[model samples]
Target: MRLFLTFCAFFALVAVVFAWEKEDHEIFDLVSSIQASEGKDVNFYSWLEVSPSATTAEIAKAPFVQAYRKKSMQLHPDKNPHDKKIHERFARLGVVSTILRNKESRERYDFFYRNGVPVWRGTGYYYSRFRPGLGTAIVFLIIVTSGFQYAAQHVNSRRDLARIEDIVRQARQVAWGPRMVPVEGQRKVKVNLGGGPESEAPERWISMVVDANNVYFLHPDGDMELLDASTATQPAISSTWFIALVRSSYQSAFGRSNDLKEAEGVSPPQADDDELSGTASEAPGSGTVTPREGQTTSTSTGKRKKATKRR
Candidate 1:
């Protein structure tokens, strides 16, 4: 329930972060366009060609109005038809002018203008500057999820190790008695592996052999398995789901290629045997022949002799 509450709170915060108002969006757009066109360090006051301390009344007057008109006329799409960004600039000027003319919006802009605009403002901020491709998002998610899986694996490993230690301690206590003195011989004991005093279920018992410091679980078929840290499943990068999937895919492909190579390699040896049989039938004497230039020969009479060719 606590974890669920944490998740709910996290999502609530995310909703608040993305729930930008129309005025906030306008401010974001105005800041983005001015910074991109004019300069990174440019702000609302400089973009309007006015002092930072200018009052809303002063800004609503002719000086600020004239500055807005001047910039708008220069950047108007009709005036600069060849400029693809003129439309954006012209629209941005209108928003900036509107923001400075209104008492409420101008104060909002001034708050940021004094305190400085946030360098980052959630998804919108990143989308405006650094939009990721589909492949990039996939790779990023894989890395993030794989990292989380590895962390969970480590947590599980620690838990398993603790369980193993607890079982070992129980078995050792049965063998070594109250003092837990070192025992000379192996002692078999039954221990409650789970559902102890803390649990409502009946105590579950298992037979195990305790030899000095070593502990082993005894099976019904007279087989014993050692129980220790080594028995616990260890965490590793390869154990993570994504890495395991990739490794299995690679191994399957490699095994398939090897099987194909073996299948292809078998026919060549059969062909070579056929060629050797044909060569033997074409030999001069009634005997098996090897495909070598100089060797001993057994003729039809079964006499061994050196086979040679005369020019």
Candidate 2:
């Protein structure tokens, strides 16, 4: 009997080993990919030779501009004819300086710099930031809004449709991400286990809502219909499922956004606003005021008084 019980226990361990859910595979695979990915973006601060905390007000000082000009002069293509790569470095220097010098551009870059830019966003992975541009909005409006108009185009239906889209958007925002499952009980969620360029994109996520008695899968053709969840795979899940959905939606919309930006005549890369036109204006305490080459400012009381009088 003791030997029989040992054999039974051994078999139970084997069964548990094989019982790892499909989601466990996907989650581990995705996280491992993020871990191994070579998607680290460049840090503009390091390129500019400035402290991370350096303020724009402080950066516009003569001392900083003097350093930039010195580097620019050395790296100027006319001067570095032998170094073919010097132009690229020189161009980068100008860009970094402009980004850091401008208050708006600097703030935008700093937000990503300090908070950490999302590596998995809008790439191969199912994660991206929500930045719906004018073009995307127009296409979506035409598809959904016009579809509503065609099918019983009632004003009330239009209002309800808009409301439903808003709710789904809000719910989707919180779905996919990292979370601390408490020490006690686990919160159960349902996630579809298939997705990629070749597979059914929406099938990759059948439905995220576990509580909705009648769940619906959103189709690629922009139709939402009631479906029997009895046959669909369901698993207790986490935010990672929702993140996959968000990434899928935003990435598709983003592709459309490129077309829209082009139509709207907005260039993706514009000259930065903080470009120094004339010599930088001297702000208060603009670093140590050094006399020009070959000129000396008198330190004696008599010469100082004389200079003040001249001013």
TM-score of each: 0.69, 0.27
- Tell me which residue pairs clash in candidate 1: none
Q: On residues 79-189, what C-alpha lDDT tens digit does candidate 1 reach at each position?
A: 899988888878777777787778898888777777776765667765755789999999999999999998998999999999999999989988998788879789999
lDDT of 1 at 32: 77
Q: Count the backbone clashes (under 3 Å) in each candidate.
A: 0, 6
Candidate 1 has a TM-score of 0.69
Question: Cα lDDT for residue 182, model 2?
Answer: 26
Question: Per-model C-alpha lDDT, please?
Answer: 0.82, 0.54
**Candidate 2 lDDT, tens digit per residue, 1-311?**
99999999989867655543443333334333333431233356554457779888889998778878987797799998998667766776676688779887677667656775444332222322245688987776766754554454344455555645543443333343344222222212335444567776644444434123333445556455543423333322222334455778888999799988888896467544344322234665675443433444566464632222223
Best by TM-score: 1
Give the number of the best model, judged by lDDT: 1
Deviation from native of the Cα of residue 208 in model 2, angstroms: 44
